[model samples]
Target: MNFTVLVPARLASTRLPNKPLADIAGLPMIVRVAQRAAQSAASAVVVAADHADIVAACAAHGVRAVLTRGDHATGSDRLAEACALLGLDGADTVVNVQGDEPLIEPALIDACAALLQARGDCVMSTAAHAIDHPRELDNPNVVKVVLDAAGRALYFSRAPIPWWRDGRIASTAAALPSPAPLRHIGLYGYRAGFLRRFPALEAAPLERIESLEQLRVLWHGERIAVHVAAHAPGPGVDTPEDLERVRAIFAAV
Candidate 1:
């Protein structure tokens, strides 16, 4: 299966201003993300930048970058315009890799694309891993996904899902039950045609309440294939603290 990785980068960030240009090791964060995506099975890797500076940063590192409209409300919307600009066919697969995830694994990108290629009925695919800590299950920042019998996402939310009625909430990770909850990863894969139509889909109430864009697909009666990742995804840069943590990890390496 052929796939392309599109890194959607915006200049304005509420938590960390100009996050895409933030330094990681020596290279910019967006450049690092593109370098990792290039190692995957994807046929091409491109950065769909919201600003000319972001496009220039990617170009400096010899990565393909495209300037997209800055007014896009969501990453999917930005990628939709990118697909049109690239002139990608309807059947082609595209993976949406966030620009802030400098530590993202290339294999995870391939896995997500492969899931979509294998599942003809599903319009999109994403990954998740089993949560090992009780705190993570309760944390609203860590999204959780409940899967159906066929490994399709039943729902994605910030709240604790499949609430363990028999178990009591505890502070320690050891107190969690045998079958732990699954934490949803932020990566996604979609067909180029579906990606174009994504922006046209009406915003769903569940999506607005949960603040998860994927829920819009479920609300509109579309199937999303959920792949259980072999390992947890690396942390993404959302705040100054997150940037420091990632920088420290790179420095240690």
Candidate 2:
């Protein structure tokens, strides 16, 4: 079987409530996200969510959605359950797309899945983009990632990384380095077998300190393939202001 794309949507968010149902271009945000996932080369595109509201929204929009465990700590956990419900085999590749990204490109989805397929040694694959703006460098909300020459992730941190000992790192007040920094994109692709083992792995100190589950995989000595996306990932709708901003952007598309 070919790879499957799972769109993970949650109704609850600390910053903005009922984000999946938020309207963008007259359709629910999750609906628009699903539409984008459908453009992928995936054999199937399904929404994995915990709330009935999200499920109903997908149904109304003629999209496939499945209710998952409400207690899943992470979106990846939700995707695992979605795969189980769909009866995917261990070797099946699963692409996890965040539902808040209504404008996520289908090509990005295909690219991530293709990377995982090409690199059989890695169980997980994700993406990054060169951060050019000065504001994005200091924005703690925009997670940063550094990768090795082989395009494998070295670290994922919310703080500024690769401190320039002579330039930016030399002075506390020095301007942040705007070039070569890669902002981590939230989309992920994982083999079904590895995903089933994810929940059982003990949490690592770095993961707990940073509140990032992906860190646990790195800390456990596993390599995650990183793909450099050609374009910036569309801004995800996390706050009310962001909702308005995304709506305006989608309105023009």
TM match of model 2 to true structure: 0.93
Candidate with maximal TM-score: 1
What RMSD value applies to candidate 2? 2.2
Compared with the true structure, all predictions reach lDDT values of 0.92, 0.86
Return the lDDT, model 2, position 46: 93
Q: Report lDDT (Cα) of residue 242, candidate 1.
A: 98
The 10 consecutive residues of candidate 1 with the worst lDDT sum are 169-178
lDDT of 1 by residue, 154-233 (tens): 99999888787887655564677667789999999998999999999999999999999999999999999988987798
Model 2: per-residue Cα lDDT over 71-95, one tens digit each: 9888877877887899875778999
Error of 1 at 68 (Å): 0.4
Superposed by TM-score, candidate 1 places the C-alpha of residue 215 at a distance from the truth, in angstroms, of 0.5
Please give the distance, in angstroms, between residue 160's alpha carbon in candidate 2 and its true position after superposition. 1.4
> Model 1, stretches more than 4 Å misplaced?
172-174
Q: In model 1, what is the error at residue 9, expressed in angstroms?
A: 0.1
Name the runs in model 2 displaced over 4 angstroms: 169-179
